[model samples]
Target: MSHAPTHVTCSDVSFEWPDGTPVLDGFHWAVGPGRTGLIGLNGCGKSTLLKLVAGELRPTTGQISVAGSIGYLPQDVTLATGARVDEVLGIRATRAALHAIEAGEATEANFAALGDDWDVEERALATLDQLGLAGIDLDRTVGELSGGEGVLLRLAALLLARPDVLLLDEPTNNLDLRARRRLYAAVASWTGVMVLVSHDRELLDRVDQIADLRDGEVRWYGGNFADYEDMLAGEQEAAERMVRVAEGDVQRQKRELAEAQVKLARRKRYGQKMYENKREPKIVMGARKRAAQESAGKHRIMHAEKLTEARERLDQAVEAVRDDAEIRIDLPATQVPPGRRVLTATDLRLAHGAAVAGVWEVRGPERIALVGGNGSGKTTLLRTIAGLVPPTSGEALTHVPTRYLPQRLDVLDDESTVAENVARFAPHATNNVIRARLAHFLFRGARADRAAGTLSGGERFRAALAALLLAEPAPQLLMLDEPTNNLDLASVRQLTDALESYEGALLVASHDVPFLESIGITRWLLLDGELRSTTAEEVRESRWED
Candidate 1:
């Protein structure tokens, strides 16, 4: 019998960027042979930690020890412009293997040099089949592959490496629903120690443990995403208690300092009278002066040093115990009237250049999730609805106002300013109003004047949202295409909060289960040959935490 390896360990770890902002501090964790979901908002150092564990980055302090070989697949895809798909996979450990094979040096040393064993190429082919790349020519250039297809191909190649530990960063971001389901199932059944960072709540629920990174600290929770949610409530309550206790101590110290000052002043006044009176005895006056001096000296020392230290401590305690700190940005009001059936589509079908067709039927005021496997036409349906693409057959009716926020914020003019983008959407709105609305979304003053192209993904999303709300009649029918992509955790939360309150029909096509859940999606349309209504059970049962 063999035991599972204790894969990765980090002790007394801390990290900081060049600007001196701390990302992680005093973080310690031990990952064994199991699935671990690393959960955190964007830029909380989730990806940074993954890179550190993969040995791609060095920690500013402390030690990281890995038990064996590790494979990491980043959320973003990196493709060599002119390289072939099969060529990319072969290059991974093949140069030496091929050299040995070509040199007629067929030995155990050569075979082991390629990987742990000789069948590396065979394993790669099988992995390629698993990713739906079996029949395709492996020698095709990567530049010829579609964006979505390339992502899958690279992922398959990475999986073939058969590493002891796998670090996946938002692995499901660009995948369709079917592909996502398959990926989720694969992750849940994998034997190695798998650490994944994802915003999808469904994925989080399948993991054995969840490590929530927040405020430069890791809060370990046993069980799945649902368990972590319950634990989070308790943690928030405890943090509040700490804040209350610190505040009470602060008040008590203020009172003590006031009382001490009064006593010191009285002693000084009495001593002066005794020293000035000619009839007073020399011994009494001398004693009075000495007592006064000692009292004043002691009071000064206590008030300046000890009392000051107490106050400083109180401040630190209060700072450490923040309870309700979250993203709370004010967005511009759309105030669009809820009219009858802003959008309606029935018996709708879509295809990818006459290849794969998707089924769909959606009604207004109904929150519908278009779900299917990879190449299932989720985007095709969205494009058809947005009028970017014409449906092959079926009727799509728009009764009232409508607006769309695409998955790619390409509608934005990169060369334009943030204010200019808003103005373009609502040409009638005055400059002052546009600026005010932009400020509400946390784009204030000089920041609003910055070029739109230079803004971070989160900022760009916020700006586009601002532009959308500024549209005339403020579309009651809002369509979002993967709106949460590239947004930070705080920004995602803010976006969710905004959508939750919007009193309009929402039609969103997204793989982000948590974001969907947050906004309360009721109906689901599975993109098969035709639209099929999905119950909550179907979704809950099939959706696994990554």
Candidate 2:
């Protein structure tokens, strides 16, 4: 497909928090007319950078020039009280232009204002329709929409604007499996330049490019997340070699400089001290002085220059791969013997309102992935397992203890501190013990005391997961519902590593195919009206990139 040339060009940008801590340092990034996945570890300024690109936040230094109009769906948006999906779309300027005709406000001036061809109404509806949001009434209030619906409404508004660039920040955070698929499909169909910040491995895989941000810089990887991982591994190995070489050079230079210093010292000492008593020629003394000065100056210059060069080379090498500095905590979790049939269901069915029901039966340590297009009922099955909903007319039983991580990090208490939340969830543990445990999860000292509500999405998820692990005896059956929704690459890796080492059964319902595979998922139960066993080969095919 021939594509238009759309891009977001930023040059010499720098940003610092109000408190003066540097967040971004002379950052330069470029995104072109294709889906570019923004990958970074948690707290790495990915969201902040995305905001700057979206023009929501101005750069503290330098200029950001976007080639065309912009559409931004931020990671967080609180719908007005009692507002409905329809109302949110209506707030968009393009939608207003379309609505003007119905109210007889589409005057000659309005037509001329749209430029030569006019027909602004048609264009507006077409844009909305492309996102599968057309024909929705504008009067509906935003407060009545479901979380997933609210997300789609915001997306619809952005797309209807026919933006030259689209910036979506953590777009899949609150979406269920079905909604996520829909969102992905919508993104896939979008033709303009797109930059999205998300922890969703599935979404990252689908994009054309992956920009892995660490500290304040970007490393462009031309492929899906898996490909990026492979490249990153190679880069890391190369960087290590460079660091070793630089270290050796520095050592060699130090030895040479030391030798030079010794030689100069010996030469000076060998010279007779003919200050007043010895009959030494003045010309000879002057020659000696000149020789010593030249030799010392050469040694000093070489040593200083070599030292400066070595440090720069070493720093460059270190910085090249430092983006992956996130600790990969690969320690094994405490084991719990799995009971027979972790969860069982027969002819189970569930649905919300007019949406069709989803049915399935889950048993064993299936490592199941509820695969389906967006709007499918992957989350419903998880909720059913959690006993949040009763099946329409079927039998279901869970024989082992099941812990659920909701898609929205809902396990965390907004008002309570991280330590408090962990302690509350773990009643048997004392305060000191709980604090120590929280520290293991990277919530230490002042961080542990901070309110859970104020923590970033990744932090909140980690805190919740830490709390879950602290459960007495560790859950025999763990259920993670879209667990990668808001996680950055580091958090994702850490969580995956922990889960891989977990001894208990895992039933993760996620779109993160690479993550599931990395942790050794052997089987899957594709959610639909019927259950299907998926092998590794099948799972590979189910990857978002495929």
Candidate 3:
């Protein structure tokens, strides 16, 4: 497989946006027959590189060669509302021509359209079944499917093409646990050269190798995500050791330079005293003083050069260490007493017709994980608790202030800057206060001044999170729906770090089991037609049924 004639090759490629913002410069890459996981921070061009390889976007300067046909499944899958499943699969015309020929209307046009695929329908159905879409009707419209189903449908279409090279970009973004499992199975069974860009840790754990895209370059790592982490941990340890050694060398150089200067000053003072006391002749003393002064100048220059070299080495050492800043801020005002009721839903029935027949009370700073499949009213439940949706039967009450972060992250005004958005949330806070808080979210100075609309996916998430957490009332109760959907691993880690300092009650609805576990969830409630208490193991083992 290593010598499979390079299924895809990108040589000296350069890509830039229309406004001259560079994404990749002089990049080079090649992939053979195997599964490769592409990972990086947000805005690092993982998706853009996939687009270039799939021919959706062309590189401004270099050449990309493909050995055969290519198939691509984009991050956001959108199909025409009126188009049928078969049409989206690219086999509608072929199926029609085959049917016509079988019905005794074997015209030259029908025969030409049929081509060589005599079992097109069967192949399409098989591909759909392989992706867990067995029961889906080929005649159904694309608009009739749920978001997760739509993503799977797009993957099904790609599989039907049977291309030599395949690319998937965040294929599991909207998928639930079961759907993600199906997609994972598909990825494991891929035979041709495949490259996938995703933040899904479970999915990435199945790849043959990892290609870390950072600073416009790809660094290859053998084995899966777990192996990559182990390897990276070793490298970081070595880098940190080097940094410490370099720091010690710099301090030693400074001390030696200071001692030399002090000794030279003492010698000059003694010479001046001897001259004043007339211990030697005036001409001889003058000559000795001049020689001493020249020698001191040379020694000072040598020490200064040594110190400069040591400082340079220290700078290089620091650069070798990865200094990815994390979000660290205290939310002291958000604290709730152990007995204080944060939220209560008593016989609540949502305005959307989903009902919770029992009373549910959240006390203190409890972390709740709301688990459910797609279209299961998890968002509605959170919205109801936050008072965005009114209950039809009973009340959903919060004793303290509450904030809801929707899945789309529409909490902030797109036209406003990050600091301005935070100010909008906390009208009483001063400009300096807002800027200081924004810095904790990794948006320092001018970065906090950029409009929310221009921020990348991860930056926008951080801004929205900052706005919510730093509000005037301080969000004693926070509700988040799928907060980790499109965030890269680094951003997810930052979110986890930020939440670590929050003392408020948390109610997050997400399919990310590892994230939920990391946040110290005290309760797990499964949302179907009713609110049912569950556990982490149960959530992991349970599968969605059709």
The C-alpha TM-scores of every prediction are 0.74, 0.69, 0.94
lDDT of each candidate versus the true structure: 0.73, 0.72, 0.90
Residue 164's C-alpha lDDT in candidate 1?
A: 83
Q: Residue 495 error for model 2, in Å?
A: 1.6
Candidate 3 C-alpha lDDT tens digits along 269-378? 99989998998899999999999999999999999998899889889888777766799998899998897988878899877777787778999999999988888889
Clashes of each: 5, 9, 0
Over 94-130, each residue of candidate 2 has an lDDT whose tens digit, in order, gives 4455456557897765554444434544654565565
The candidate 1 region of ten consecutive residues with least summed lDDT is 353-362
Better of 2 and 3 by TM-score: 3
Residue ranges of candidate 1 with Cα displaced over 4 Å: 1-6, 9-32, 52-65, 78-152, 213-222, 262-290, 300-310, 322-339, 344-365, 384-401, 411-460, 470-473, 487-490, 529-534, 539-546
Task: Pull out the clashing pairs in model 2.
Answer: 82-143, 83-141, 83-142, 83-143, 84-141, 84-142, 84-143, 178-374, 178-375
Candidate 3's displacement at residue 327, Å, is 1.7
Which runs of model 2 end up more than 4 angstroms from their true locations? 1-22, 25-35, 60-63, 77-129, 132-150, 172-192, 205-210, 220-230, 246-319, 323-339, 344-364, 371-384, 387-398, 413-454, 526-546
**After superposition on all CA atoms, what RMSD does each candidate show versus the true structure?**
5.8, 6.7, 2.4
Task: Output the worst ten-in-a-row residue range by lDDT, candidate 3.
Answer: 1-10
Candidate 1 contains a number of clashing pairs equal to: 5
Residue 88 miss distance in model 3 (angstroms): 0.6
